[model samples]
Target chain A: MPSDSSPPNRRGLITLAWLWVAAPLAYGVYELVHKATQLFTG
Target chain B: MSSPPVAPAGWSRWLVPPAALSVHLSIGQAYAWSVFKPPLEAALHLDGTQSALPFQLAIVMLGLSAAFGGTLVERNGPRWAMTVALVCFCAGFLLSALGAGTRQYWLIVLGYGFVGGIGLGIGYISPVSTLIKWFPDRPGMATGIAIMGFGGGALIASPWSAQMLASFGGDNDGIALAFLVHGLSYAVFMTLGVLLVRVPRTGDGGGTASGPSGPSDLEGVQVSARGAVRTPQFWCLWIVLCMNVTAGIGILEKAAPMITDFFADSSAPVSASAAAGFVALLSAANMAGRIGWSSTSDLIGRKNIYRLYLGVGALMYLLIALFGDASKPLFVLCALVILSFYGGGFATVPAYLKDLFGTYQVGAIHGRLLTAWSTAGVLGPLIVNWIADRQKEAGKHGSSLYGLSFGIMIGLLVVGFVANELVRPVHARHHVPAPREAADAQRQQPA
Candidate 1:
């Protein structure tokens, strides 16, 4: 077992996990914003 | 009290939020059900109201399953709970696919509404208590991160699902294929949450309560879910949540039309496209408020933040009631603010529960409290729609149609404000006895 205070190297895993959610969310927000522009434009 | 795969030494607590987001974002697709409605209605030859039954039932089931499954999730641990959510949620999509393929509306209802709703309920609460435990120092911000994904899920899902429907074609076979893709992909996505999640190791500094240093920090009070509902504080929070959700959902359900109606007779009438944009803006506000305002609660305190939601929310209603047609910007601003408060109310409550009732059985307690949401889900839209229908019958139109509804929302907000005021720390009597004390007491009691 690792020592109680030890910090494991999970930097890559964390990045991958965060990206999985963020990428799609960014896409959705982009579309939503694109659609929403019509309110001001029209 | 949770399942195994506890956070081993050296693990970063930060991984938990993404784990939670995986589940929340997937289930948050519930909000994007409207995207499927038009396609389903067209393929199934159903009217708007008939097509709506699935989403409505799904909401009801979300509350019911959450209220019931909360304790089981706490008892079995998050992994077991998350796996259950995965199975139910993914299976729901598959079943809906089968239903759509067969042209059976009731099958789709059963698949998505009943089965999938259980996934929503279980998935919704699964990460909440774990997040609170993981980030005891900043419970509001911690829970806010995970819950924010729920709001944002629709943002991603709305467009993505629409694209899928477009590419696959909106016919029945196409919709079925879309459902198949959603189920399979979501299954893959949610697996990350199940695999990555770990209950915090004891004495990790982040997981356990560091100490109850403040008078407001009643975490050491340790009330069980059963003990909590008996306390007035639970009911007060219940009323608080119900009224807030009711007030917001009323506006949200009617938003696209409400904005148009408010300005219908004015010099600047809101066009259909602008109305759609207005709905999108409200969704943005709702999603933003979940993370933004809930995190703000960490510094301001939960009670103070709620006072802002209820108090300011009531004022916004009053503004709409008295002078909605007077200015378009003012009208939109008030609606956006109310929606943010609606989302904020959801994100802040678990942390608020941690403050009053402590982390003991909090997931279960939260589950029980969600019954209030179920109540509000029906009540808010009912009050708004029924009044609008009645007003139309009375030959009313424009902003006049929603005047009474806005007044009722104000009344609900006032009630919520009072309920927030009534909330205090749970009494010592309600606190669950420590394990040792319980053992000793149990030994003395006759079998």
Candidate 2:
């Protein structure tokens, strides 16, 4: 078994995961923005 | 816990959640059913209920397929499960497109509800156990991140579908085109998950090792899926989940019209456009709550968080029933909080199951539990809509039309609150003996 320390690259992996999460979330936000613009402007 | 296949060096346990998110976000489009309802009704000459059949059937199938395919998912691993989900989900859309082009409503139901729902079921559970295994220290937060994608999927799809319907013209051809695009796009999107996902090995520092060494490991009795179903604990959770979902869906399924009706007589009356905006806000609340509230469970403990979801959720409903139309902001606040609890209830349940059943077959048990969601899907809308329709016929207007339904929702939440209180740890007899138990026993023996 490996030692009981945290994984060496744990931070990097978490950063990558955040990137993955951010992509779709950005798209969702964009959609929401568009809808909000329409709701207010129109 | 059964050991996962060894992951290679440089593989991050964090990658698994994104993989799970990919599948969830795609299948979560099921919540955007209302986007297609108007166009389907126009083209098919159907009533409101008729147009709703495809989505309703899809939910039913989601629960059924999850329950039935859960064990297979556990055995075959996430890649196999995601691949099956991708095929069924994409194919369902394609078939629905074909059905729309041919003007066969039954075909749409069959494709989206039956076949696609199978995909939803399998795909929904596919990554759950894997995630719980990967993030043993923070199961609630881990599952929350992925399932939140499911809640947010409709946010993307609703606008996208509305645009497609507008561009294509709201006829049979337009609906078919929209369906085709959804299938093709999602198939491409879901492939990312299948490729990125990997199971961690036991004691590989991905959070599974917890006996004497790891301080963060979950200490609990493990129960198999079959054993879990027979337990009173499982049934109590089932009722809790069902009631929670039923209450939320009662408002969610009718968000737009219900709000319009509620404020129709007010000085600043709600317009159709404003109602659409209200739906969007509810979706935002639903999506945000999935991640926010479920992540909170990791801090507060799953049982304590559920008390908030069921207990406070009932109070929210009561507020809405009593003071809804009197003040619009209060009504919106109550509804938003209620919706959030609904989303939290969904995102928290997998971790709750992990706490009770162990990671060995948590995905399968979660699959069985989702039948509660299916039951709620039917019951929630039926109770709310049936009462609303009868009130309309009687010429009742505004909040009065929904007062009775909200009252019923309050009752359901109370039942769920009781069920949540009744939940206890699984019995030792139901727990599967850990493989390491025997090895540890042997090692401890004196010569």
Candidate 3:
């Protein structure tokens, strides 16, 4: 396994963790709309 | 191959709790269910009571899940607690979608009720005890940070859900689609909480060297989760939380319709967009109260602050009820303040537990105490919606129907006010500390 070099500082870790949680959620919302459209109009 | 290095604790630990907050704040926004009431009711041609089931179920789940899952959360840690929340909350939506598609009211309740309610319970307490352990010196502030997320969950959820409902065609399909999105989206959001959360090492996580932190001044003062339940203070706090939540939710469940009715036939009647804004504003107040009032508790003490939430909150309801259909700004102002207190009541209670019960198993105790909230979740909306439905049939509308509802809320708040006054310091006999286990906390100086 590669040695993880991300989040060199505490603030960086907070930011990285936020991104980790947020990106997936934001993506999920986008996916939700996409799926919703396919269901409604498909 | 080398193992992953651990994070050197302190300040670095703040990262996980905030992620937990993000998920909680979003879901807590579900309380702003009134924001969607008109459009949903119109689209489905349903009555007020019919439209309220999802919101009621969500609150029921929040309290039930939190109460039932308290011990499991303490044993398994935040990761496990939050993982369960994501699955259930998301599945609730999927189930709700099927219900909406089939137009089966009971299915909607079953899906969101049993499935998602479990998620709410686990998610609510996922971080309480752990957060307290990490920051023994500032238990109030630490728990406040995470709980604030829950307070604000609705602030973000209200607007986003409204926009989703609007975009997805604003009918049963739209509502169904919104539920699906909420479930899937929350699962993804809460995944961060699960991924990053960790229990602090026993013995205050690093605040002390040898063992768990305890009162340095007192020779022995501790209360385990099991023991905490037996205390008068626990029951006192339970009554306090239940009464406070009931008062706030009574307004929250009916916010959209109530506000629209209050302003009916006014020169500047509330438009659709403006009504949505009213719900959004309440969300902001609810979210802000969590952080603002709860943080204030650190300085003022939980008892005094609750005196304000209950006492002042009751007074605010009086203002709304007496000044029937009064100035728009006054109505909005009083409602906002009341909603803030509601959110504050939730955010402050964990720290209240820390102050009274100690951190031995606070998360578990906090979970168990949440059953009061579950009880209020059912009672509050039932009282409001039930009365309003009865009034609607009796040719009542607008302020008249709600006048009765607000009167009931005032009585509940007053009852809560009495409970707050009855809170006294727990006696020695009631508190049961862990046995002296050669721990170093005995030698530490008190904060």
Candidate 4:
């Protein structure tokens, strides 16, 4: 966990905060893996 | 307890509600996606289970994004948060449109699941803590007003999406066009929230509780986001929400297919339009659950309302399992009530957290706690879909496949019921003293 007391690196922290953008994107990618594989097999 | 500190100068508190309304309305569209399910499945020649992917992914993303974004929303305030939500939500839709148009299923998942999910999470928490700050006196009503927007989003989105699809026609081109429109429309709609929201002045944060309008003003207490997570009550309530949501979703995800399947071999099989009506009815129940049952939580207390959700919800599943297709009205009525409780479960939980934890960082904590919801989102659909799949392979037909699914839901709810009963007040060790209290304690300690 990032310490609460550190000086707020506004840009860096904002980037980190929004990095959760990856989670859903990653999950979406993960969920469709089988279909992608099926495309090749077919 | 002392009255919350007064607001700082020049902050416009009232603007917050509209900001909340914007996000809730847009994210709420998730409830209405089923309106488009049939045409998409037919157009794409996908299986019933495959058709459910986009909606399921959207929901899972909703919980995940919300859980992850909870704290950032607190630090950045509603404006920044709302902006993030708008961008992601719109982008998600656009991506999904591209995916649909080209027939690449992965794109739909990318657009809606990852992109749109972030929008759901950020939009969800954007106004939560700020609203609490604005209406310290009436946390439930404040949160309810905003959360209700989410519940009602589907009510608006369902008819609107249906009409759009109807006009556009059900080909891949049409569906993709509809998604593009949804993305653009939501972007426009959510702009209202971004422009209108303002944090309350720091000194003004006290005493505006809204609810059943009688003696139990305590219905909407405020708990800070951080303090809430430290308490066992938060986790216990988290279990209650996950269980309640899972139960309702299990039925909801399969409502149309289940109904049609149930009546297929029977004398009074459901027709196409009536099945459409069934989906609409479930939407109504889902919307009503957010407003009706959540508002009711003010009078009954959070625990008691959850008790109703879990206990009554379990019985509703049982009725469906034992009775089979005996009475359509009974099934519909029970399903509606259960869905309402599910919606209520979502709308009222923030208020319940307020009552237990106090509003210091309630929004952030609420966001964190939403991980439970994310977990339930996946678990709920997986349980329902997986069980149904196995049942189909076993040659189970119609409502019989649902029996095992509903039975599993019942067991889950039972465990949730126990968890609710176990919730108790926090001990002193977990309590972080307010700034004033900490200052006073320091003065009294030996030098």
Candidate No. with top lDDT: 1
lDDT of 2 by residue, B137-241 (tens): 778888998899898788778778898899998899999999999999999889878877777654543444322111113356777789999999999999999
TM-score sort, best first: 1, 2, 3, 4
Task: Give the alpha carbon lDDT tens digit for every residue of B59-110 in model 3.
Answer: 7767766776686676666666677778887887799888777777677778
Q: How does each model score on lDDT?
A: 0.87, 0.84, 0.71, 0.72
Candidate 4 local lDDT, B1-447, one digit each (tens): 112222334334444565687678778787667777898788888887877787777777777777767767765666778888999989999998998899887898788877887888888887887776666555666787788778667666766788899999999999999999999988887877776666643234442221111111122333455666767888898898889889988888778788888778888887665665676667667766776776777777878988999999999889988875787778788888888888888888887776676665567778888888778877888998998999999999888878888899999999999999998866656655444533443456479
Consecutive 10-residue window with the lowest summed lDDT within model 2 chain B: B209-218
The Cα error of candidate 4 at residue B53, in Å, is 5.5
Q: TM-score of model 3 relative to the true fold? A: 0.78
DockQ-based ranking, best first? 1, 2, 3, 4
Per-residue error for B355 in candidate 1, Å, reads 0.6
Provide the lDDT at B177 for model 2.
96
Docking category for candidate 3? incorrect
Question: Which structure among the candidates has the greatest TM-score?
Answer: 1
Tell me the TM-score of model 1.
0.93
On DockQ, the candidate that comes out on top is 1
DockQ of 4: 0.02
Q: What DockQ does candidate 3 have relative to the true complex?
A: 0.09
Indicate whether candidate 1 or candidate 2 has the larger TM-score: 1
DockQ of each: 0.47, 0.34, 0.09, 0.02
TM-score of each candidate structure, all chains considered together: 0.93, 0.89, 0.78, 0.76
**Residue B67 of candidate 4: its Cα lDDT?**
73
Which is the better candidate, 1 or 3, if ranked by DockQ? 1
